[model samples]
Target chain A: MKAFQSVAVIGLGSMGLGMARSLMRGGHEVRGCDLARDALEKLAAAGGSAFNTPAAAAHDADVVVVVVVNAAQTRAVLFGPDGAAEAMKPGSVIISSATMSPVEAQEFAARAGEHGVLYLDAPISGGSARADAGELTVMASGSPEAFSAAQPALDAMAQTVYSLGEDVGVGSSFKIVNQLLAGVHIAAACEAITFAKRLGLDISKVFEVISKSAGNSWMFENRIPHVLEGDYAPHSAVAIFTKDLGIVSELGRKQSFPLPVASAALQLFLMTEAAGMGQDDDSSVARLLAQIAGLELPGMERSN
Target chain B: MKAFQSVAVIGLGSMGLGMARSLMRGGHEVRGCDLARDALEKLAAAGGSAFNTPAAAAHDADVVVVVVVNAAQTRAVLFGPDGAAEAMKPGSVIISSATMSPVEAQEFAARAGEHGVLYLDAPISGGSARADAGELTVMASGSPEAFSAAQPALDAMAQTVYSLGEDVGVGSSFKIVNQLLAGVHIAAACEAITFAKRLGLDISKVFEVISKSAGNSWMFENRIPHVLEGDYAPHSAVAIFTKDLGIVSELGRKQSFPLPVASAALQLFLMTEAAGMGQDDDSSVARLLAQIAGLELPGMERSN
Candidate 1:
């Protein structure tokens, strides 16, 4: 394993924190940063140094992983006030693991290049559970040097890192494609289950049958349990897809590609958000659909 | 096994022919009927007797398995001129395996009862390959007597027979739910693949990553190979989803439930049908999408 002696993980959210711990477990000297004090403290207690800002954590690191929310946050973390780019050593790798448009990724990579830093446009999949298990799948694209530089952290955090090619934005493009399908599938799963509920079929039975049938998706298998158990505790929240699919819609518009199915799915996520369940598990879109149809879902009471 | 000595199968389509052969292999005196002479001759060559009409084939049969396309054809096969219902024994079972509304299943069951016959609302999954292998899944609902009478053929035809309940419509309800999801997932797969193409990512590479990642569906796994191979030969035609999702749309409208995602999927199938690829594989919807987006899918010649 190509092992970086010192690695900095900026943004200690669920995915970031898990990744940071995984890197530490892989025997790297890890530094973590996040605005959330609890997240910072948790990593600190786990035998890694914690910093309040990205730059301070990244200052002496051999490799920095930016696992922030989106392109804007990724940019802010690297180029904002007290940003990591200036503090990082020349030739250090920046592994950007945010879901963003290809254009943004390319721009970010070019900016990082200007700072004499190699950038790997890497976007991650698998939920935080996989991240905690150190088995996340990464879609990555960059120069050979960037991949070689990021190898240590990538090996520590990912079970599979798709070496997409030499283009800076290809990873982002792949991730966007994945988000389009994933978001559509989640909404479709919610729609199917609620539609089953509306049809008076046993929702659990529908889940069981569909899981074994041609109807099933990875999202359906993973997310339908939340609907079945009436547990909307967000493993992946409604707002996450709302944001992701919004990116899809924006990209589609720019490309003159009409994504009608994705467009429809986005509307459902938007409706879920509009119903104030944006922070809830995405399966709560089932609840919203049920509400609109005047159908009662298992763990939901009728407000009227 | 509650083994019936004799069985009759109506509508020798791909699914019906496979199921009929499976019953024959199960040691039943299987009789088959179809309007298509080629289908009937194929069954006849396989050692099952073939008849010109449903009644002649069903005459004196202990179980009549109706495996037609939809509710209307199901109704016509059982009760139309020279129908099977009038010719079957009084206590014989009628297994309706078409995808239909719960109301239609119930009405058919009631009519069968009036004819002094038993009815099993058994809708099948697992497609023609499984049907040929006699390993299909059957979502079945009927009286104990009806189940007992149909057991031999069911045992031959299905690996998993989900006994939904005593109610005649329950199996149809489950089936409708499955079709709703299956149709939507297929359309979602097409949309995602085409969207990937629009983004200039290698389609096969996108398929590889997404299949291992979260965006995958059973349909995606099964059907995308057809797209990747540039083979649009109809394993399941675009018209099938057009018809099945039409059922979904009609059911949604009748129940006043908005199946927005399903409606979106239905429109895509409708467009595929409108583009005259109705007889091609359902994945041709991806080709249609590519054409619309001015993208070239593998094996698709530009029409302009």
Candidate 2:
């Protein structure tokens, strides 16, 4: 198994930035790219290379990881007018780490294969903290060669790497399924906490107890504190779920699947976005619920 | 505080049956009452006394715990033609353990107060297994004297007791909020897993991977296995959520609160019930999603 020596991370947002740092810590020659010059300059200041275009970073790199927002951004990063696929060397691997449709992943892989490059459908989970700690969980699938090629970077960036199957689209399939639950759980948790608060129960007490009960979820325990602290800062923003659940609903509809619960969750997230809380942490969905109920949320208490 | 030496339990279904056993284990002399003769027989065999009427059970009881199905049943047990409240001595405490609306709870307390009895609005969670293990969670609120009076049985039956406040309805309110999340989460999990299976992703692998991911929830991790094993032996039944979420919607309607997410979840559970899985485990909601999509759930292959 040949080790990856140079990798390009295209997208210098919170997740992308932490991933680039992990790659650099793994002793790879890391090139980071983003439209934001300040983000690129920050990466360069941290001793990584900065490139204006994804193609410049992917031109001679052994691995190019695209961590942009959704399928369109993923497609643009890989095959846009000056996309990375057109400049990548033969046998170089493209590890798409964004949340995208499984069908889109299948198409992306086929396009990469046509350009004589490998493709691994790898969508990451865990926040920036775990990403920076090199302990994220990666749901990954690809051809054996792509897996072998991506192993070093995968090992450096994740604590748990689920080797789903040799099929490129399956990883994305699993990841989208995951996002459906994750997105819904966050919205549901927000609803639970805010509803409790509306009922005049202590928010901290509800958290203290439910976190230990079966009513709890990973998202519930993790996100309720943000609601309690009245901190709407985007650990994971409502806009993210808007994109991810959009992918989920679109794919579910394509398959003629009735995902009423997930669809309802998508609607709540949409309401949150429409109410102008889209930039806030997904927990801010609680505020939207409170608004619709005519009950003032703790954080939004002063607004009235 | 005087220790409760003799207690009477109303209702002998799964939850009540388990509670009777836990009370016996806690060294209380318990008399169990329910309309079902067989359930009462089982309780008698399990070391508790059995009575045909609540009045008979409460005749010599120090504490009376009503674990019936709903507000109606609870009212019937407490104040019907031959109710426990009519038979019990003044100052005997009643722990109402049914999932009920806040209005019903307050009315129940007022009615109990008229009988010179104390009422603790206590709605239990953690399911039958926890009930059997004497490790249930009780969301309880009442007058301090009522809490003190119910402490012995509460200690016996619950691992966690959330003291909501002096309000008679606060505990029921919290339980309703918890139910809103629990029902939505379980349904969302079903939707995601069935959606994944419809896409032809490996069901076991999807469960294995997603359970460790952010997508994981208390319901997903616990109930998806029932879907995987094709076992829907009613740990929690589909009809349960329909009833609970109905309470939520009814409360919302009365309060003029627009509960979009909770209402949507209520509809899905109602659909699951309408699809003839009403008696099946709550996880059977997963099968409903697959049925609507015209896709075969992987684990149900055996039944086919």
Name the weakest run of 10 consecutive residues (lDDT summed) in model 1 chain A.
Answer: A1-10
Compared with the true structure, model 1 gives a TM-score of: 0.98
Cα RMSD, model 2? 1.7
TM-score of 2: 0.97
* CAPRI grade, predicted model 2: medium
Supply DockQ values for each candidate: 0.83, 0.74
Taken over the whole model, the C-alpha lDDT of each candidate is: 0.91, 0.87
lDDT of 1 by residue, A1-304 (tens): 2455699999988899999889989999999889999999999998899988889999978899999889999999999998999888988999999899999999998998888999999999988999988999999999999999999889999999999999999999999988988998899899888888888888888888889887889999999999888899989899999999999999999998888889999999999999999999999989899888888877888888
- In terms of DockQ, the best-performing candidate is 1
Can you tell me which runs of candidate 2 are displaced by over 4 Å? A2-4, A301-304, B298-304
lDDT of 1 by residue, B177-249 (tens): 8888888888888988988888889989988999998988888888889999999999989998999899888
Please write out the lDDT profile of model 2 over residues A151-237, one tens digit for every residue.
Answer: 888888889999988988888888889889888888888877777776777788888877876677888888988888778999999
* Fraction of native Cα-Cα interface contacts (under 8 Å, chains A and B) also present in model 2: 0.76
**Residue A80, candidate 1: alpha-carbon lDDT:** 94
Q: Compute each candidate's TM-score over C-alphas.
A: 0.98, 0.97
